[model samples]
Target: MNSEEQPILSIRNLNRQFGSGCRECGGGSGQLIKNYCLSCGTVYACRDLSFDVFPGEVLGIVGESGSGKSTLMKCLYFDQETTGGEGYISTYKDGNANLFAQSSQEKRYIRNHLMGKVYQNPILGLKMDFSSIGNIAEKLISAGERNAAGMEERGMELLTHVSIPVHRRKEAPRNFSGGMQQRVQIAKALSNNPPILLLDEVTTGLDLSVQASVLDLIKGLQRELGISIILVSHDLGVIRMLADRTMVMLDGKVIEKGLTDQILEDPQAAYTQQLVHSLL
Candidate 1:
């Protein structure tokens, strides 16, 4: 690749609006939109967002609850279709291409092989009834690893990497504490060996000590795998520890974005300053 080439993932002018009324008022339905939900009886979940995720870079996206952080991550991962603007994912498998414009089949193929996601709620991303190791191995197989032995080996390695005990690997996630369950979720997300990982508040419900361990596990994995990561969290401390850069969002719009320290130490926007204060 040339030095001038863009990063692995690039999002430009992305917008996502919800509700039926916005659909009628010239804002396309599903992912696109024009007027606010109040005026058109449709909710606007995310609006005019743009960012990039480069290879081996961890970008932290911070916003309060209902600030569209999750929505923006969904759009980048193609879990939610865009209303407008362009999104691109560049990889050796597909070369450089527009993500939103890809056909359903193309998107499915990429999603299965090239990207992985960890939801804020562990239960949302994991099967409560399955053994922790089984859950991770199942995802590996689903992502195209057909070798049983290989899957088991990789699953055990991942479990260990995240600090899950070997014996506990046989236990169902329901038997694990909140932090352990989150580690299992992280292990499962890495099962695919995806080039891009979307972590949506992976540390949300954990206590402070557990959160630190989980964050350390994530940083270690990133160092080993060299995969680009997008971390969505309301916790500034989490972002400060893991992210090289940070983006701040408010009411679906990007209020400020820069290096993590720059934004935290010298916030440019009032919302960003208030968010930092809340952390203190």
Candidate 2:
């Protein structure tokens, strides 16, 4: 992000702990001896994670399974309650208020109106039984849009934007191929033109060719719409293709972060170097 322009979203000391506390493990403080405390079974799913996502930038989070990438995304979207920290979106309250501090109703408003998310599983992101347009309309409905014609028109536009045929708008996502289902999810996520988009391993199970097409569609949409995006994936290749800046996460902590090219070229962390070499 440029020094002059403020980040669209800023996350500060974000923490998500899966257990209450355990004195033997420093009660969620000091050195975390293990992810699970022998005494309390408290799991520190995420540490004091912090990052900023600038408008119109794709910030990629790459890590292996159990690296806490999905957990972080869930916390950001409020699907999983955060244990601690402040989250602010510039589009909300002139960027002066922490999103986590907002009332439940206010939080819902922000989520439905300002942020959009697509999960790895189509079932989570798309309603298999709903028509493609019906699924997109669900978000618009949540945003208080009641005009049926407008919703249909908007859905058509989004489907077209994602390269889905207009005639298929009435078809169920369950009947579409994996790639088509993912495109439907993308359309649904963009239904409200949210400033921030969260994608959690959206292409993990797809064929290589399908993955490439979805990745390309994502890049095109982000550029065309100028939305800030956080793409979580285990694939460094996907991150390299789409991220302007990248954050490397391991065991719930960000080990390294920098321009995508710089991090790939001269990684400082051992884990990051290993990741780069593996790609090579």
Candidate 3:
């Protein structure tokens, strides 16, 4: 939480919109019903999002559905293009480059070598037909690991780290349970040993006991690897458990942000107050 330490990742004025905006809405002068423009029909999914993820820290982004938290994650991971913004990763180009404007080839390099992402849906992150270890190998290969023996060793190590049984390494993710599929996805994401991890609702929709286990696994991984993480979830409880700092988003804008303990105990924004109260 040192203010002076260099950030591993930095985003500035990030914005994403579904449709071309009219002058009224596009100019940031008109009011919208929720996040959609009534006149021009442009949906501003993410607006002016800016944040930093410090080394070895978890920065939680909490928001309701359609609050643009997931959109922000997508932009960061390059699953979706940003309409406008700039992003810098300390591990890339000495943090001098804007990631949003990178060429496709450069973006691929950054995605493969500098960052990892685990999607809420395992299908989005894992190839359902591929063996669990094969999924991990795919990531390893993308990161330029051409030696099959080396990849197998790395894949096995990652699967074991995520608690996936050795015997089941050859099974496809389609055969695994919800929680197990997520574990495999996590293993695959970590296969390249990326410095930054993006986790979008990793524990969502799991049974209570299963959710607890996945959260604990993530907590342990962060502590062991010392990797910076950006975790997006609507669950305040999840943020409380893992995040050192938390940001609250509403209607595609950041309403409040601060240390997790401070926000939970004395939330400043009215919307944040309701959210914190609900966690009781």
lDDT of 2 by residue, 1-280 (tens): 5532899999999988888876777745644654566677788878889999987999999987888889999988888888899999987998899988888899899889999999999898888999999999999999999999999999999999999999989999999999999999999999998999999999989999999999999999998899999999889899999999999998778999999999999999999999999999
C-alpha-based local distance difference test score of model 1: 0.83
Winner on TM-score between 1 and 3 is 3
Ranking by lDDT: 3, 2, 1
Tens-digit lDDT string for candidate 1 (1-280): 6623458888888888776554444553343332345456665667788888888899999988888889887887777887778877777345567778888888877777788888888878899999998998878777677888888889899898888998788899999999999889888887878889999998887899988988898998999889899999999999999998999988788889999999999999998999899998
Q: Candidate 1, TM-score vs. the true structure?
A: 0.90
lDDT of 3 at 233: 96
Q: Please, what is the whole-model Cα lDDT of each candidate in the order they appear? A: 0.83, 0.90, 0.92
Kindly report the root-mean-square deviation of model 3 from the true structure over all alpha carbons.
1.5
Q: What is the C-alpha lDDT profile of model 3 across 1-280, one tens digit per residue? A: 4533989999999999998889778544477888999988999999898988898999999999999999999998899999998999887888899999999999999999999999999999999999999999998888888999988888889989999999999999999999999999888988888999999999999999999999999999999999889999999999999999999999999999999999999999999999988889
Per-candidate TM equals 0.90, 0.96, 0.98
Q: How many backbone overlaps does candidate 3 show?
A: 0
Candidate 2 structure lDDT: 0.90
Better of 2 and 3 by TM-score: 3
What clash pairs does model 3 have?
none
